[model samples]
Target: MYSFTGNGNPTLVGQLSLAAGGIGLNVSQDGKYVCVGGVASANLYVYSINYINTTATQALSNSIVFGNSALGSNYDLNVRGLSGAQIEIDGLVNYDNVN
Candidate 1:
């Protein structure tokens, strides 16, 4: 992820190893946190942002895994709240067997 200042200079805030598939990203209303969803890995990651001296730093705060089931080809993530305390994730899953 990157952060842009008023002068339009971009700075590397953080980075994560995402799966080889489409990924979803959302930022909190307060810009204090961000959530990312990995479609291929079926996992979610939350990061906290700290700013100092016009530089931003991101730290992994939490992670949630949704088993190995193959999530569909698309995913969407939405975060809302005063401090981004609420998160809603939706996605399509592919199921090959049912018994």
Candidate 2:
């Protein structure tokens, strides 16, 4: 995922992989971690993002992990960028736990 302030610029902000059985996902207020949910059940899974390298051929950008338990009923997961935000690929959404 990427984010921009106001102009149509691209900022590789974060990346997320759907849990094996996750459906919906969202970020916390501070943007430090992600909250995921299932499709048929009401469960929220928390994940943390990690950044390794800044300059390199294979620079480590973002990393995440599905939390232990699900936290809320699952819903459709959609990726939406801010004024200048964009995402490569959105994950699957429905009603299930993937962590």
Candidate 2: C-alpha RMSD to true structure equals 14.1
Off by over 4 Å in 1: 1-21, 53-99
Clashing pairs in model 1, backbone N/Cα/C closer than 3 A: none
TM-score to true structure, per model: 0.32, 0.32
lDDT of each: 0.50, 0.48
The worst-scoring run of ten residues by lDDT in candidate 1 lies at: 90-99
Quote model 1's TM-score. Answer: 0.32
lDDT of 1 by residue, 34-69 (tens): 768887878887665443232335522333322222
Q: Kindly list the per-residue Cα lDDT of model 2 for residues 1-99, writing each as its tens digit.
A: 455469888666454555666565666545666756675676555555332324555533433322322543343233345575456544322223342
Candidate 2 residue-pair clash tally = 19
